[model samples]
Target: MGGCVSVSSRSTCSSRSNGERISPSCLWIDMFRRKRSRRTFSDHVTTLQHLSSIPSRIFTNGRSSSACIFTQQGRKGINQDAMIVWEDFMAEDVTFCGVFDGHGPYGHLVARKVRDTLPLKLSSFFDSFGSKQNGSGANCCNGNMKSDVADPVKETSTEDRVESLWREAFLKSYKAMDKELRSHPNLDCFCSGSTAVTVIKQGSNLFMGNIGDSRAILGSKDSNDSMVAIQLTVDLKPDLPREAERIKRCKGRVFALQDEPEVQRVWLPFDDAPGLAMARAFGDFCLKEYGVISIPEFSHRVLSDQDKFVVLASDGVWDVLSNEEVVEIVSSAPTRSSAARILVESAAREWKAKYPTSKMDDCAVVCLFLDGKMDSESDYEEQGFSSATLQSNHSGNVVESDDGQNSEPCLQRNFTVRSSEENDQYRRVPIDADVEDAENGGTEDQNWSGLEGVTRVNSLVQLPRFSEERPRP
Candidate 1:
């Protein structure tokens, strides 16, 4: 497998001391001589100072323009899994980063495609949501402070609607990519899948969405003055009850690896699609038929001033360092980029120490540091309405034929609206397992205050909601 990567890395130096004023010819002559010495130097340094005397616009990012990506090919004995860091310091108010960890063959292509497309999909969704607002009232996504109580129901409805639209758009994008893969003469014979973890920063709030086992962590300045890693998303492993049920429905079972000498082998069952351990993922088209869904889990939170940095990494790095260990290492580092690189390099070193004669697996990590400046979290709290219900089934939208199979149809229908209090805490437990099946119930409508228009479909695997009543250290 081959990897195609384009990366740009930049470092800006801010110094307080001013050098003694020098002659223009001395600087010009030195610059000319340096240019003659190195051909590549001509492409390096495109700072405004070199181009013209006009002043450069100061960006809100607190740094000059910078971008970088790193790509590598693993040794012949190992999988050529390429990892990347596509950081652009100039984006300001929006720090975008993602981790793509691939397995099987041509993992590099999977990594490259994820890095290029995922962020664009998210940004486009945001754009669509923002464009709906008249922009004159309290609807301002540009972070300008405006006063007015927002409608929580409307906001929730808008958010849910946009989220569902984006989810469909994401699927469409993947389907288009699949079409391209089938048509391309060069990409045939590549059977691979990758896990993606993408994080986007809007002011002080961070939104992280992930698929598979890749992870993202938020490190906060703890009470002891040391940084503590606060995890955002849950790892989608085969152990979860919901996941176990899904796998079992697919005629596959997860087995505990016993210490027995004769049964020491750890492997997925023969009937399992792709013979992979992960229960949920993207690009493993072979498993889609059996309900091995690729729905992503997301976490949205406000980062306080006490927050230090974020770490997004592949399983290769996590296999070595725990969250606490990662916090310790990142806290000691001077910059987020260095911490990210160190994490990957550290994992490689650990692998070498454990196996003296073997090459390590491909590893990658990306970290974004909070530069001690305060950005109001409220400025980034997305306020909108979303009306996407959990099930795709509704009255006339999808019709059931006389044969009990769904028929293709185009329709719109009114859906039952359940209030937060009325619909709160309804669970369906089957009276008899042989006769009845448990159906998803409801809980208190999860809506941000005043944003009542947003109607969120209940997740089957609901996470315990964070509450101010309960202490969360």
Candidate 2:
């Protein structure tokens, strides 16, 4: 005796087996709810899949929507340079870029390891501290700099806070990275190490961290609307005054070799093994005990409308091309995607023409455009001449002399020169006169064994330990 019950003017339902009434409207609503639940579940799965793919966004050697990266192997056995540009690094609108230059037998491995893991560590630190605005996180990041009188929390500006947060992140990440290298089971970092030049761009703010000799520079427009090259990171060579002081204080020796007087290197106290060209780097455990640290120099900058782009590169590029030359080459590029490749090619040609007899060092570059655009038409017309012609014109401007006197552009002047009187202050490991003569007098056809730019030995030889008591000679 079941009969249909009309719930509304447009819908009705029949009685069920239990003699209860049901409305078609209710049934439709229930079905719609179930369908929506399924749809929501599917959306969540899709979101998780996208989140898992974030690592794929890190480009090692390619062009991205906002950046371009390129690397070239040298005559050296293997390419030891590594670089990356990660978009949406930690949060939306943030980007991270880095260039690593490895030196020593296992330098390539060390560089790649840092290139992959460092940014992750930084992101982790940033996230861990981001939640606690006024808690132990802030205090720990600030170290012992908390003011006793004025409230630092209230006195800090927006720029200061951002800089402080990133500064802590860089410091901790670099220290942790070096520690990991020291304890890594598979990697041998005893005498091997890598240089790092990294930058994080969040909106209009830029934070940079650097160690060793790799460099970062900005290409910006001046008041006259002319392109200008601004160096961001100092090359942390062993010859820098503060760097030399720290190494000497830690019982590490710093001096130039007989052949390359202009290049100063860090050496061991008891033995002349593993002469590292830079004052700071990741790995090189032997030198680590002798004041070679892995601490990065941090800097911050607020981007301006005049700012054009940034270029991060290994020492290989810097050794041959000047900062202005690099900026000119990049600005004149026909397209943003081709800028890094063109710059690397220009550096390669310069290396061949500048130091033909020397083995070229590995080159890596990352070019980041700030405004997300390049004036291809203007650049093409401005640089109508070929790269070779531009290079020839640049080379003809000034000649480098033996006395280090050059009318060359002020920025291109070499600063590694140390007077003989200055050299007398440091204890130098003596080299056999015969060996020195052989190296200097060697023929061009002779195969070079050591690294070219830094003059690194192939392997570190362990010398015999001398006894406290001297026997008759």
Candidate 3:
């Protein structure tokens, strides 16, 4: 807790419009309640975004009613996952949460870079646009609420504009991120990159951006008041027909190996170089020609009064835990600060049990309770569930699948797909021209690929830009 850098005074970043700045407070997961200090943007704007990844859990307390906890562990010896959450984003009632999952040789570097930098980009843009979301300045931002402003008109006018602003920021930031990866003096993205899935919660609305296989889900009460899982983003895997179709349309090969029949991947049209499992990602310049893209899938949802929490996780968690199972585990946590840690530990245990032969993958989770805060005085009774009973009753329960319908025992065969060499009619053209493929010198690909110390991440890049010219090897 002491070692990890805790970002504070993020509300100051929203001060340009709200004119309200928060006092310095520990801004990690809701694990630790530190003394609050009034800080300003000029104070942390530079160093905060460059904060290094930590091996242990990091807690950043923002408000008394919100709690977020994070944890990570290495699998197969490398942890190529990263996560970041900026609750009280531009608008006080909003939160920005992101998880990145990296694969390949330099995946760890790419994931960490995105994990630390993306939110800063989003925050900068939000403040720049001056787009206001209703209730932005109320108690949420520590600013005065415009009580005279009508809700309907203010919401109707601001929602679309603010949303459009966020979309533009996502697109621009993703593009810049990929470009940075490709040109990184030390990192190589030719065959490496990461998946990204993020959600911006402003007021009751959620805006999500996803790329690759990692996922985001919401836990809310159905009409009957029972807890239910609502999937907020699709897993952008190569198996998706639309994804596969797009790859083929770009002359990119999309098929699975005989041994790994279920795991569809993208390969170089000319050389069997890097094979990426997800359809979209940042970097992976080598596969960009074969229809592998970095653009994100964006969607929006309005929160209901019954909405309880949101979960953003890397594939490591999704591969073993059902959206419902995750909801159950988190919802049952003895406390809000312990929710993410418990969920990650559960995934690690499942990975060991289900895939005994393979190394465990890095796992990361961000849990935001709708009304839960980071106050030490807030008791479990106030968190909407019985802490004493939530975890005790479901402590040993096994998770089934993503769908939550199957009750079968957990098995490796249910999620793991082996990779093998199999070929379809994929074009592999050799190039004679002096192609600038190695446009940027990269980080030690071999070393970073294993992510010896890096931990978990998730989801995307910019929108698709189909080019007629083939990619060079």
* Candidate 2 local Cα displacement, residue 287, angstroms: 0.7
How many residue pairs clash in model 2? Answer: 0
- Tell me each candidate's TM-score: 0.54, 0.67, 0.66
What is the alpha-carbon lDDT for the whole of candidate 1?
0.42
- Candidate 1 lDDT tens digits, 205-296: 46566666667788898788877877665555554445656767775554432221111111234532244445555554544555455666
- What TM-score would you give candidate 3 relative to the actual structure? 0.66
RMSD (CA, Å), candidate 1 to true, equals 22.6
- Candidate 2 lDDT, 265-373, residue by residue in tens: 8889987876678899999898898989999978777677788999999988887787889999999987776688789889889877765555566688999999765
Q: How good is model 2 by TM-score?
A: 0.67
Clash number by candidate, in order: 34, 0, 40
The per-model lDDT (C-alpha) reads 0.42, 0.65, 0.57
Clashing pairs in 2: none
Q: Which candidate has the highest TM-score of all?
A: 2
Model 2 misplacement above 4 A: 1-56, 134-156, 374-473
CA shift at 393, candidate 3, in angstroms? 27
